[model samples]
Target: MAAAAPPHTDHKLGTPILDQPQLQAGGGTAAVTEKARTLDHISDNFSKYLKSAYDDVNKRYDLTTKEGLAKWLVTEQQASQDDVQFFKDGSFDDFIRYYMSGSASVMRPPPPLDDTYPISNYFISSSHNTYLTGNQLSSESSVDAYKNASVLLRGCRCVEVDVWDGEPPSSSSSEDEDETAAPKPKKEKKEKLGLRKRLELRFGRKGSPPPEDQSKPAAASSNQSPDQGADMRIEPWRSNVSTRAEPRVLHGYTLTKDITFRAVCATIRDYAFVTSDLPLIVSLEVHTCPEQQEIMVEIMREYWRGMLVDLPLDSSQNSEEIALPILRDLRKKILVKVKRAHKHPGAADAKPSTLQAPSGEPQRSSSVVSTSTSSSEELPDGTKKPPAPKAKISEALAKLGIYTGGYSFKSLDQPEAKIPTHIFSLSENTLMEVHETQPAALFKHNKHFFMRAYPKGLRLKSSNLNPSRFWRAGVQIVALNWQRWDGGMMQNEAMFAGTAGWVLKPEGYRSTSDEATQKTAIAHHNLDLSIEFLAGQDIPMPPEEDDPKDFKPYVKVELHVEKHEERNAQPIPGGGKSKGGEFKQKTETYRSQNPNFGGEIIKFEGIQGVTEELTFVRYVLSALSSSFSNCNR
Candidate 1:
C-alpha cells in the first residue's frame, strides 16, 4: 500500500493538500527512464494500431499515396484510436476531445480559506471553487461608481476650485503682471501699456517704451476711478486691445478638471468583488487628448494580437512539421474576431512552403488564398467574393471504435454521434487547432474583449453555487467606455481578463447536488483553501503603537464563518473554576454537542482566484463611506 503522505501545501497555489503528484526526477539514467514513462502517459505509441487504421482509411477513401497526408503533422498521421487532440498540438481529426492547455493561468490551487482575498473583497466563483479579484464584476459597477463621484462633486460645488492657468496666450508675458499692477494714474493707461508691452516682448520688439507722464500714485487713482454720475456699471467687454493681445484673468472662469487615475483605480477596487447581476461591460478609456481615442483603441487591439497570436508558432520548432512564418508573424493585420475573421492568408508573396499541399509538393502557385474570409473582389450583386473551398476527406477514415471514423467518436456503447460527424472539412478534422492557445484575444462580444496571455481554460464543475446578486459597497473604479450591449454584454459571460476584473455568475449554472449513483462513493477533489494566513490579530492595532514598517499594503480579507453551525459560542473557556481536563470529551469532539447545533463541518474549502492586475479608473464615495459615522467623504 502507498504510504499516507504528510500534509503539504501545493507550491503553485499555496493551498493545503494531501496529494503528492509524482513528478519526474531530474536527468540521469534513472530519471531519463522515468521521464520516458511519463511522456508515455501523456503521449506514448509506436502507433501500429493508428497505422493500420490509416491504411484502412486510405483504402476506403481511395487514397493512393503518402502524398494524401503530407499536410499532417507526424503525431497527427499516426494517432491511436483513443488519442486526444487540441491546440494544433494534436492529431488531425475534427472529432477529438480532451483539453490540451493544462489549466487557466499558472496559479496553484487556492491556499487555505483564511489566506484568500477577503470574501468581502472577492466574490465566490459560481462553483465557489475559485474567485476573481481586482476591478468590480460589471463595467456598469465601475461606471455607476464614477457617475456617483461626479454627482457628488457637482453637489459640493465648492465655493473655490483650482484650475491650471494655461500657458499664457502668445501675446502675453509673465512679466506683464508686475507692469500692470504698478499703479498707473489712468486705468486705461495701465491696461494699454501692459497689453502693448507683452505683445512687444513676444514679438521680440527692439524699441524702448514710450516716454511716460508721471505715473499717478494710489491716491491719484481713486479720483480717476468711475465718476459718481457716470455709468458705473462697467460691462464685461472684449478688452479694447487688438485681437492678438490678451488679458490674464487669474481669478474667474469655467474651470474643468479630469478624474484622476488613482481615484479611478480606487473606485474600481472598492466594488470589483460585490456579487450582483448588474451588467459588467468594460470600456477601457484610453483618453488621448480626446482626438486620439479612436487610434488608441486600434493600438490596444494590435497590441493584444501581437502579444498572444505568436506564442504557439514561436514554439513550433520540431523537425517534422511544415513551417508557418505567417502564423508566427502575427503583425499581419488586425481583424475583428467574428465568423472566419481569425483567418487571413498568411502572406501571398511569401513562399508557400508554410502551407503544405496534400501531394507533398511545395505549393509554388503565384496566388494562394486563405479560407477565412470573403474575397476582396467585388461582384455584380454587390456581394464580396467568397473564400476558396478547401479540399476535404470524403469518407470517415475511422471504423467501429477505432481510429476509423465510422462509429461514434466517444465510445463503442455510450451513444452514437448525436448528429452526423462530418460537420468539419477534412483538414479541420485532422489538425487539432488550439483555440485558447495563445493568450490571444478570446472574443469581444460587446465593448469588452476577453484576453489571456497565460494559462488556459479552467474547468468549472458546477455553476449553481453562484451568489444570487452582487453588492457594491466600497470601490472607486474606472471605465474607459460604456454602452448598452447591442448584442449584449451580460455579466456572467465576462471573460477573466488580466486588465479587467469580473464579479458575476457562470452560465446555466448546473447543480452539483449529487452525481448519478456509481455504487461506490467517489470523492471529488476540490482546490483546497488553507486557513493559516490568519496568524495576526483579527482587528488592527491602535495607531500609536503601530510601526510604519509593519503595515501590509493589501486589504486583508477574512472569512467569518459559523462555528459548527451555531453551537452557542464555546461557553467561556477560562476561569469557570473548571478543572483543566474536566470537559475533555466535549473539547475533543469534532461536532458541537449543544442540542442547538446541527449539520457537519463544511467539507469543501472555499477557493478563490486573485486579480493579478489592477488600474485606477475613477473615484467616488466608497460604499464604506457610511460605516464611519460621517467622518469623511
Candidate 2:
C-alpha cells in the first residue's frame, strides 16, 4: 500500500525554455507490427461489438422508448424523449452509429463529464525529443517521431521541437563513427565578456554606456513615453542575438542529425487531425535569428493556415494572461507555446522593429535554406559579438498563444507573483525532487495551472518514469519518449487508444470540487474488494529442461497504491507463506494448459477513498519449488 501524497497551493509560471521530448529503445519489430495490425482492425471490431451489444439489449427489452431506455440503461434525464421517439421511428439504423454521433437517445458512458474545466484540468499525452528515433546524442531526427504514424497519431497531444539557427546536419552519425572528427577548441575566442555583461547585452542593455549618456536623466530614454503609440511594442528579447548556428531541430550538445522546420511543419499539417480532433501544442526550444523566425512563421502559415488558431491583434485583448481554454474550444487548432519576456519598466513605449529579407531572396523550400536578414551588436572596446540572429515572433503567432504562453520555473521558494496562469514546464528531476520533499505543495499548485514534467537530461537511453504518480498530482502534460517502446509507452497507449489524446482529470483533481470535502468523505468508511482467481492458460516453459506435464504452479497477488507507504496483504485459505505476505496459493501439479484454481476467493478490506482510481493489482504465476529436510533430502 502506498501513502496518499498531499496537494499544494497555486503558483505562476516562469520563463519558458526549450521543448524536450522523451526517448526509449527500438523494440521487437514483430510485436509492433502485430500491434499495428490489431489497431487497423479496431474500428471495424468496435462497431460490430457495439452493434451486437445493442441488439442483445434491445431484444431483451424495449430500448426505443424514452421510459424504457431510462429504466434499462439507468439514464432517465439524459435520454431526451424526442430522441427516444426518433430511434423508435427507425431514424437510426445502428445503435453504435447513433451513440458515436452523440444522439440524445443513446445513454452512453459519461462523456468526459468535466467539460466546464480549463485545459489545465485534463491529462494530455506528450512526447519528448519528438523527432528522434534512437539515442539522443547519436540518433536520427526524422519528421516521423512516431514510426507507425505522426506524433498526433501516436496519441501525443504535445510535441517538442528543437529550433536552432543553421542548416541541419543531413544524416545521422553513430557515436563510434564520429570519434575521428576534429574537436573544436573551447578557448578559441580572443575576447570574452563576463556573465553579468553577457546578461546585460543579451537583454538589449548597453554593456557600458558613454559618460555623457550615463549622466542624462533616467526618464529621457523612457520607452513608455506618452508620445509612443500602440504600434511601439517591446521586443520579446533585449537583443536580436542568437548563439546557435542554424534554425534546425536537434537535441542540444548531441551528434544527432537535424530536421528542417519547414519539413516538420509540412508533416504536422498533413497529419494534424488524423488520429485526434483535439488541439495540438508545439513546444519550442527556440534559438534562432529574426530573419529565420520570419521564415518559420511564413512556412508554417503556408502549410497550416486553416487549422492554426489566429489570435487577436487588438492590444487591449492581447496583453493579459488567462487560464487555458477548454478542449472543445480549440478543436483542430495548432498552438505554438514558447517563452516571452515579462514587461520591463517603460516597455509600453518601446519602439518595435521588424526585419525583412533582402530583395531577390533565395527560394525557400522544405529542404534547408538560409535567411537573408542580418543583425549584429558592437561592444564598447571596438570588438563585436558574434552576429546573433534576431527574431521577433510574428504578430499572428503571438495571438494563438493567448492562453498557452510559456514560462520557466526553478524553485518553489521563489516569488510566484510574477508567474502567470499560463503553462509551466519542468524537468522530471526537478518535479520529482519537489514530489519527494513537498508532495502536498506540488499537488496544490497543479490544481489551478497547467504543468508538464519531462524526463531528465541524463536519460540518454530513453527510459521512462512511473507516470501515474504525476497524473495523481494533476500534472496535465507528462511527456514520455515515444521512440522507446516500453511498459510506460504501453501504459500510455492503453490510456489514450480509443480517446482523442485527452483524458478527463479524476474527480479529486477537478477545480470545482473541494479537496477537503473529498478527504473527509473517505476518512471513516473502508472499502472491501473480493477477487476470484480462476486459472492459467499455456504457461511458458521454464529455462531448465523439465516435462511440461510435471510443472507445479501457484498464484500471488500484489496491490499498488499511488503513494510511498507499504501495502499489507491478507491471508487466503490453503495459501502458502511468503516473506512479503503477498497473497499466494499452495502449489498444485496441474499439467493441462487450462489449470483451474478450484474457486479460490481473495477478499481485501480496509481500502478507502480514491484507491479505486489510483490502485493497481498485479497477479503473478510461478512454478513452486520443493523443499527437503536436511537428513531426508
List candidate 2 segments past 4 Å from native.
1-114, 146-150, 168-246, 312-316, 343-400, 411-421, 436-441, 514-559, 564-610, 617-633
Off by over 4 Å in 1: 1-282, 286-290, 308-468, 471-540, 546-633
The local distance difference test score of model 1 is 0.20
Which lDDT value does model 2 have at 398?
A: 42
What digit string (tens of lDDT, one per residue) describes model 2 on residues 253-282?
Answer: 345677878678888887767666787888
Task: Tell me the tens digit of each residue's lDDT in model 1 across 1-633.
Answer: 011112231111211111321121110011122222221111212133334544565554433334333323233444322222332333323212221132211222222222121111222111110111011111111222222211111110001111111222344555777676666456565465443243333322211111243122223334444443121111112223233121111111111122322233333333322222221212221111111212222222333333212122334332112232321132221112111101125533344222211243211111212122112333233443332222111111011001001221222112221111111111111111211121111111000111111101111111110011111101111111011110001121121211112222111110111222111112222234322111111223222225433433221112211112111212223311121111111111111111111221222243322111210011111111110000000
Worst 10 residues of 1 by lDDT: 624-633
Give the whole-model CA lDDT for all candidates, comma-separated: 0.20, 0.51
Best by the lDDT measure: 2
Error (Å) of candidate 1 at residue 56 is 65
